[model samples]
Target: MPPALNRTRLAWAGDLPTSRAACGMGFVSTPELGHEAVAFGVNALARLAHRGGLDADGKSGDGAGLLIQVPHRLLGGQYAVAALFEWDPRARAIVEAAVTDGGMRLADWREVPLDHDSLGARARETMPGIWHGLIEDPGVDPDEWERRLYLVRRRAEKQADQEGVRMYLPSLSSRTLVYKGLMAGTRLADFYLDLRDQACESRLAVFHQRYSTNTMPDWRLAQPFRMLAHNGEINTITGNRAWMRAREAELEPELRGAVWPEGSDSASLDNALELLVQRGWEVSEALMSLVPDAWEGRGDLAGPVRDFFRYQSIRFEPWDGPAALAFSDGVVVGAALDRNGLRPLRWQRTRQGLVAAASEAGVVTMEPADVVERGRLGPGQMLLVDTRDGSVLRDAEAKERAASRHDYALLADRVLVPVERHHVDLEPLEDLPAHHALHGWGFEDVKFVVDVMAETSAEPVYSMGDDIPIAALGRTPRRIYGYLRQRFAQVTNPAIDPLREKAVMSLRVLLGARHGTLEPEGGTDRELLRRHHPAVPTEYKLLELESPILGAAELARVLEDAVVLDATYLPDESLRDALHRLCREADEVSGVIALSDRRSGPFRLPIPMALAVGAVHSHLLATGRRMAADVVAIAGDAVDVHDVACLITIGASAVHPYLAFATVGDEAAPRYRKAVEAGLLKVMAKMGISCVSSYRGGEVLEALGLGAEVMEMCFSAVPSRIGGVNLDDIERMA
Candidate 1:
């Protein structure tokens, strides 16, 4: 009997190496080189055997995989359809159903020839039941049929997931093929006989060796996904995945119910890229949109280029993290680095028209004289090869072409809502009367939070060995931000040093509704979202309240453009209901909603700023009104640097910490802002994020005591396991 479908293996199921490391290599030639390229790839894999992970049993490897353009010549010419399948009866039925549903007939079927016994007993034991089949659909365009197959595959996979069957397609394309598994590099070539075939040749080949830190390496999780292979971790994956699911309501029918596979962040990223490519986005555009550079504030970029990124930023969040990725569509092949430049990718071009890139230099050996050029990928850089043209495109040339594809400057300038025009003086908070200031800032807050800010102009740090109670174990109730510890980059990918790389960091943020796609019919209101800027010039429309402990003048300014919903004296149920109504009403008003706590004093506390901002932000997102409005946090409770960062991370577009600034005095306001900016930059860099905008609303938070239901609704996708406090519990604490 074939191995049971459920008994799949993963690399991290075994012991992990003390020091994390990973390696990947690829080779592409102009003409088909058959077994020669395969042989070289295999030999290179063998050379990197140390990089392959060990499973629990220690003998079996975690995973290894290779990708190549499909070799049609080996099949003896044109065929109607060709596909691989598991030998299970259920698998067969599912494929048949998919083909019929797609209105394509299976004219014939053929198994890929292989010697089962030739692979050792262990290899056979690890294998899934496998077969290759063919189909025929007369008069159907090949590309269209491929698309139909993609839909069919998704349908089958979804059905299998529902029915408890293991079904996957290593390669299901006429242009490219993928072969990967949970096997060591040394055994991969020996276990899969196809790698030895001289006829299996192609112009481009890329590969990935997994070193997953958080997830166990599973058979289906092996790399060199359909169109790309990713190295390094995506630190922003939680938020990235959440945003993808949130937009599902707007996705096409074929893409509906399509789920990301259960794998590492890299796998999920590949899933996103594949989805976009299938929807007809150019490979370069899709990648650039997902992994954009720090283009917003950089005076170095041409107006068109900056406009291109700014527009795309409105449509998608950066798949921000430490990434070195290689992508292809059989015609164009390329690789990119994360803006942090934490992951290493070195490339070399040969005189013979081959371009090779890997995690490390010298993965593929060649004579120095044969090398035409060699260089390392800089931060947020890309190296692309257009196989059809047989030419390489550097980052500037590639982005320039993408930018020129549309009138991005005109679109951005016309649609972006202007925030720079709203800039305000800091005079409101500075001239506050002593009694009002005293009411806003408590004595304890002044001594600890405010004095610390005055001394360092940054968030205070605890000594390394300082002991604190874990949220799960603490007897006392904890703040939502306190329960959610900040996660940082480690091991397989290093974090960036913000001070050393200040040029690439950005605090620029866009607030408002999406402008819609580049299509001509897109909504004008949607385009209004990208206009808000963090800089002082565009600061007014974003409205900075003097404080949540608002002065009379500040209250007057906010009331002009926004409706202030008082949470100051309301009970839990009434406040929750009022906040809900206010958020919905927020969109119809000007796009700003300021949550204030002016009535609260040392004796009476307001709702926790974290809870208020989170609840409001979550509601806006749930109602599809999040992009239509911006949440401005005005609170006396935000008396420290951490409080401000927490507010922004939880979805505040702009934070007005009236108490902290007031206590520090007017002369120190600019210093306070710089310190807050620097502190937030430090936080982002520690997580391998180069842009504050990428870090904003990213939800890289892990709540310890929050109930699953409350977290699901409010902090969606955050790691809130080991439940503790519910909304009632939080209300009592407040």
Candidate 2:
């Protein structure tokens, strides 16, 4: 069996690495098409060769690639070219058939020239046959031609998957082309003869030298994905992918199957960007909406800019992490950074109309006297150059342009209603002892964890590491939280300082159905504004909160128009049955479904909070109702920060730790909530994530002793190594 298949046979060996990467990426752009641009890009990649990994042979690199404007001069203008890796003749035939089936003519097939002798031993063993298939133009505009080509590529991909034929399409676009492989950065042009040809001229080139830290390196995984070359990792990729999957039904018809499951984090980002571009969004505008800055507390920004980011946050969560991206769409080339600015990207402009940007400053050699301007991208900044009009827009100008495209302030004002704050008196619980026994709280929990947090408004610290046995080996049964472990950033990516970077982090959450993106035919600004106004009865009302912690008054406000579902199982009912019942009940509602475990008693046991939240979340996603309702967990078993974080990670939008509040009493309740918020921010920042919206549904935990069935039913997509107790054991323990 292949390694991919064999790894799934045992639970302990099934976990995949977090897929983080530290790499070198850059781009070169000119006012006019020229061979020098391509040469400059290759030269920049060679300078960054030290950033990539080398095989034992020392000749092969982890991965390297170049994305350039379509070489119309070399391929002969008026045709769409597809760069593909098809080793099997049958797969090649299927690809040709897919082209013709889409009502296009297959004009010719050119075998891409390669220097096989230059490849290392390991690279030669895995190299696929490279070919370029030219499809004749069908007398349509360039936009229509690209759209048609996209459909054809999707058809070929689906057909190949159905036939079990291995094939990889690096790119199929009329405006851009990609050439990449498993070779050293210096050898990229040496291996691909087209890069050395004078006719392969372009105005823009995006290049990448990959260093695979978490995932396996392969030829198909090389960068300069369809639209961008990315450095660093997308820490919230798991949650991003999940949300994308949930919102598939709302996507335009042409973007139904846009995201490929086998693609890496960078590739997924490229797919999403490509989809947005195909939907008529400008490249810079789409990127701004996807990776917005920290506008919540940035009073320096214009009101419109803040409103634009606020509106975008409701529809899409930020793709948070440490990222420095170089991207292009043939006509426009640019670079952007994430809010944390964990990666470096520098740019320089020369007097001769040449603009070069790279991970380092000296990649493109130039005379100091000829240098007109030079700068580096700060956190959440962008630099764009438009080849069409020979225009350059820095961070401020680019963002203002994007913000001015629509009346976002008006749209946000009409749709978003802030949750009103009010104080509510609390009474002490009369049966505190019985409640403590029922919820599995020991005296030490209050003395060390709860009391300390109440006094200091922060998490308590311990000097020595934990000495107790893992939950699987312990003599006493533990809560479900104990069987899971949290993952943090390592060498490839740096963990953020939550205290120093608190300004960039956010705990804000929104409640209500998300407004779906406009369809391709209905994307006018007027239509968008009309769709979000208060007069529109079809639009869902949004309730915004500054934090996920809900006090008594806030909880009452949330429950006024919300559906409260019991998260308890009767003596006769199975845990699975109770979960399914709750999911069914949630499916019937449209906004704010609250899952409360407060009803658990001697006659009924509470379903584990993680299991219940994960089940309902997965079910709603499958039923296409996940975005229609927000999930708030009213948990009784949650007393610590870890428990609340676990709940949110498994799809809880917010958590109300009723038991923690009851234990700490009223005066300390506010302080306890504050401590939990601080702890949650620390947990998120440790993984390099910046916001609660991105952290929610991230499923970053690794289950230590969960059974396969339990994982599949309750914790789908979460890695559970070392499978142990079954559902029956969990139920008995509960």
Candidate 3:
């Protein structure tokens, strides 16, 4: 008989302790056949729970560490621990014996002292709001309050507590959790919190304290319902913050009493849109407008699909990154990623329909299929595994997986249908009074028709600014980051359906739009109409024919004719020239356009280009990072992004990557990483550096900040763990 799989739950090295989060963040699937599936599920949980790597953004004064759930093999020992740390490699090994076994006494917890002396003493003497209880109780001893100076004492204690929190910091460190009294190991890396429940023991600050990907966690501000985890860098968070801030600056004429507190951008944005939906609009309507899709109009889609596309066309794009989001109202729980589909989100199904996502799949071992599924979403897609719904549902209507191999053999023969621009012929429109057209149309008529139409609206078109879909980003920097952040939640690291389809779809979409030929195969064909790599004309003459059309429709047509095929391939000297032309336009057309790549290597065939790509690829391999961030950061207005692919092969160092499709290809590119890492190490070796030895040898613990991670990695005999609710455990209990 085949080996039976245990119920899916999170697991790690025996030493790592499990952190009891207040809510759920990544994908949560129901456990099916045990072993293979269970292994994957737990890995996802572990990865999601694992702390993130340091922020290379140079923002953190001290480099960051991700103690979440890394494998434990790094700590060499008999029956080795499972935790490991990807650290700065500059710190000293932690003094293992320094950790005491008294279970961190109350004296060690260091509750902040609230002093009522000085300012408070004087203020309470004059003002009523200064001291609520003490003032109410006039007989209370003012001497005690005056000596302690309540607020001051609290601040001091808070500072002291901060040090303790930092000491248990994220790293290659591990912790042990008493889960059902089992010695399951978990590293600091796999310690993500699920904020869907009422605040739990370690989750009192979910709403106020955002986790420090690099910065510090402010428990005082965090509250229940806010999610905190790690993935790639998010450049768009700033933009979203800007948009939310600008929107709040104005009263909107409708909301007169609204006053959003500063630094509450993320929370406010969530609240504002939620309010809109609760007030009337559907979920799609509210989200789409906030996170619009790339504009490539499709005339063939049914109402819902068209509506979804249209919804994308109108809203302001959200910033991009590979983000693994955690959200809740202290009730509903969920997570989502950017549309580029970089990063990975995973989950295990349980009795209750909840989903968890993270950067690694093994974090949750019970459910580990990497292929795409309903609970597993593609780019530009949202997985809605609501605890309330008891089933996983796709929120935005995503294109179903294609049925047949792309007909690339006849790629040049498809047709294009662009949406006609919104312009009325003056002569004909003049004859009809615009105001009079509304003649007897009552508000009820519009509402009634819309409601009825909504139910029967063949396609799934949501309203604008309704839900902040991860589809809002436009550039490579944004795309890479968006995918990382979004899919990190998919820790089981499922495949992105669309990325696999990019090449096939690219040829098909281009052939149809550029050639102006129509060939409908199935329901999803309409999706091509919405956005295909722009239609390309074989020659200048064909380009002229489609030149008259404007807006996304016309643009889509032109894209087929002119869009860059291998966006990341180009010669060094010619690189600047090609990028200049690509970023420019033929008069009215903007250089901003769709790009496609096979994640291939024209660069490998070319020496200079190959060298560049080798460097970049090498860096990604050694560091387990991505190339888009560096490339996008360096790309100017007229820059050619193709060179970025070269960087992947050439430069070596760690960076968070956000790649998908063929772009999303495999778990990662190994050879490229080897080249990048070897090259980087060679350079570092020149400085006489190696891991923990050599003339350049440094202290391992303090220098590298690997204490927590070390504990985890060493935890097989002493595994760290996060003790919290997992979907399977909850299911079994239920």
Candidate 2, clashing residue pairs?
A: none
How well does candidate 2 match the true structure in TM-score terms? 0.94
What's model 1's TM-score? 0.83
Candidates' lDDT values, in order? 0.64, 0.82, 0.26
Instruction: Please write out the lDDT profile of model 1 over residues 128-219, one tens digit for every residue.
Output: 76555455543577667667767777877777778877677765665677777666665565656676677767677776766657786666
RMSD of 2: 6.4
Q: Model 3: runs farther than 4 Å from truth?
A: 1-49, 53-217, 220-232, 249-289, 292-303, 329-332, 351-358, 362-375, 395-734
Which candidate number would show the highest TM-score if scored against the true structure?
2
Can you tell me which runs of candidate 1 are displaced by over 4 Å?
1-20, 32-36, 56-59, 77-88, 113-126, 135-146, 257-261, 296-303, 365-367, 421-442, 454-456, 461-479, 517-569, 572-605, 619-630
lDDT of 3 by residue, 504-528 (tens): 1110011111111111221124455
* Best of the two (1, 3) by lDDT: 1
lDDT (Cα) of model 1? 0.64
- Candidate 2 per-residue lDDT, tens place, 311-392, comes to 7787788999889999998789999999888899999887877788898888777778888999999988899988777688
Supply the global lDDT for candidate 2. Answer: 0.82
Candidate 3 shows a clash count of 236
